[model samples]
Target: MRAVYILPALFVAGVVALSSVYIVDERKQALVLQFGQVKQVVEEPGLGFKLPFIQEVVSYEDRILGLPTQPIEVTPADDRRLVVDAFARWRITDLVKFRQAVGAGGEEVARQRLDRIINAAIREIMGGVPSTAVLSEDRTALMNRIRDIARRESGSLGVEVIDVRLTRTDLPEQNLEATFARMRAERQREAADEIARGNEAAQRVRAAADREQVEVTSEARKNAEIVRGEADAQRNAIYAEAFGRDPEFFAFTRSLTSYERAMQSGNSSIVLSPNSEFFDYMNGVTAPVAPEVPAAGQ
Candidate 1:
């Protein structure tokens, strides 16, 4: 009987000892709760105490945690819609407040609320800026703005947002084809305008060249006519000098030259008198002859 009582007592002591002591690790903090109410927070790493069988200890991570939200659609001031993928780095700052707000639901509840806060911040900040700015270097500023808003909003959950980042931003798939088509059309229109301007310039150049050619041709013809007239005048002067030097020889040579020219034509019919001066050189007659018609039968 003594041995049975001693064994039961020892078992009760062991149960009590196991229930009263809790361990906290360096990577985590603990909350002591009594009857579903928080009694003390164990922030340091080591052994801790609690009432046996009546108190409970909850552990929470002390390091930063990532809360990634689902991709959300947002429209900017430029009226362009985009899909935004983002995430937040955060950790518990106030253990007491954290316990009151999210200690019960633990990391799961904290993530849910933090996701909502981040999404709201992203929507509000992105909606105020143009899509071009969002895609530019200004995106850094926009992300910082989101982080500030998220930190403020998540403060109620005793969570401090270390940073907020936008991982990927893209135009909606449904709008890509339409946007590309519009850009192509704009480029084509600009190319056509350039071609038209170039063509007009080329036409002007061709017209100028044609005008220049006509002027050059007309000037050349005028110059050729002047040279021909000068030659004719010089020939007449030479002829007069020859006539003055020898009247009889000049007249004889002129008559012979005319006869030779008339006879060179194969089909020419001459009805001149047989004694005419035109044939005088051929007849070797020096006397002037009267003009006469040929006999009717001859």
Candidate 2:
């Protein structure tokens, strides 16, 4: 009978021992709570003890955690609306505070609260800047700013925000077509302005070229007329000089020239008298002699 009692006592003692002890995993921290109050926090990975049935151990991830936020629309300083998607890296820093802040709710409650804090920080920071800043490389600074704000706010919840990143920032789908159309119209207007300016410049150049051509042609014609007048004057002077040297010979030569021209046509329809001066050379008449040319010594 004593052996049976001893065996039952031993079984109860074993059950109590098993229930009082817990293993803390390397990647997680634990919190011991009794009657809805935090009694102890186990930060390191090892064996821990608590009351057999009155205390419960809650384990939370000690490693870095990830929280992806939902896409939210934000209006920047320029009043341009954009859809933003972001994520955060965080970890529980104070297990006691975490348990106290999210009593009976645990990591799930903490995550929800953290998500709100991050979203608020994103909106607040992004709303103050222009859309260009949000889209540019300066976005890294913006993310750092968001992380600081989130860290400050989430400190109350016992979580440290390691980093915050904006994965995607874009115009809303409804605005995409309108934005594209506006951009196209603006570019077309610029192109048209450029074309009009080019045409105006071309017209100016053509006008200048035409004016130059007219001026050059007029100057060339003036020079040609002057040259022709000079040549005519020289020829008349030479004819006068020959006439002065020998008037009779010159008259005979003129007569001969006139006769050849008057009878050049084979038809020969000239009704000139036989004694006409035009036929003086052709009639073999003796003409006045020309004065002899003086010798070089004379």
Candidate 3:
């Protein structure tokens, strides 16, 4: 009877032990609520106790999570409309603030709050900066300002804003055609300027080449004249040398050579007698061919 009573007490204790529960995880915060009221909040990463069936434990994430991006269009200071697409990263900070402003597991609601905060910052910054800066040059600085403002405004969500980013900014599709036309016109103007420059350079090169060709031809003609004059001088010197050796024969040979060159043309039609100065060589050089001789010893 004593052993049976010991087993019954052990069973009751086991039932009580089964009623109590605890859990530990690295990337989550646990909130214990008793009868629909906050009992305690545990943020540390270790096992924690909760009264099972009486105190309910709700777990919330602690990891960095992506906040949904929302498309927003706002006009800059210059009155240019910009379609801003943006998103952010966040995590729960204080579970109490999170529960109050955003209900349990209300990530979408939190994301809505984030969009409001991010949009306010964007509007404020966009209102102050120039359109050119927003569209191009100073976008980085503008992004930093937006991030700072979003983080500051995100505190109510019980989360830290890890980063804020702009996914895209585009003009309306209706305005896109005009922008494309303007870009095309600008490119055409640039191309025309480049072609004009190329034409001007080509003309300059052609003119320079023409001038060089003229100078080269002039120099060649001058060189040819100099060679001809030198050849005439050499001929005169050779004539003087040969004439000094035999004056009579040199004069005779020169006269005969002149006659031969003057009469060498195909159409040599002269009306001078054979004994004239031009044909004196024919009479002086040799007798005419003898008439065909009679048969020998006829």
By TM-score, who's the top model here?
A: 3
Summarize candidate 3's per-residue lDDT along 137-243 as a digit string, tens digits.
44777888898998898887777888877778889787789999999999999999999999999999999999999999999999999999999999999988987
Order of the predicted models by lDDT, top scorer first: 2, 1, 3
Candidate 2: list runs displaced more than 4 Å. 1-27, 30-40, 45-59, 99-110, 127-145, 246-298
Using TM-score as the measure, what is the rank order of every candidate, best first?
3, 2, 1
Error of 1 at 9 (Å): 17
Q: Which model, 2 or 3, shows the larger TM-score?
A: 3
For model 2, give the 10-residue run with minimal summed lDDT.
289-298
Candidate 1: list runs displaced more than 4 Å.
Answer: 1-68, 95-112, 129-136, 246-298
| Model 1 alpha-carbon miss at residue 260, Å | 7.8
Quick one: how many clashes does candidate 2 have? 0
Local accuracy of candidate 2 as per-residue lDDT tens digits, 216-294: 9999999999999999999989878988998787877766555556556454455757786555456776556322322
* Deviation in Å, model 1, residue 43 alpha carbon: 6.4
Estimate candidate 1's alpha-carbon lDDT, on a 0 to 1 scale: 0.86
Model 1: number of backbone collisions: 0
Report clash pairs, candidate 2.
none
lDDT score, residue 274, model 2? 76
- By TM-score, the better pick of 1 and 2 is 2
* TM-score attained by model 3: 0.71
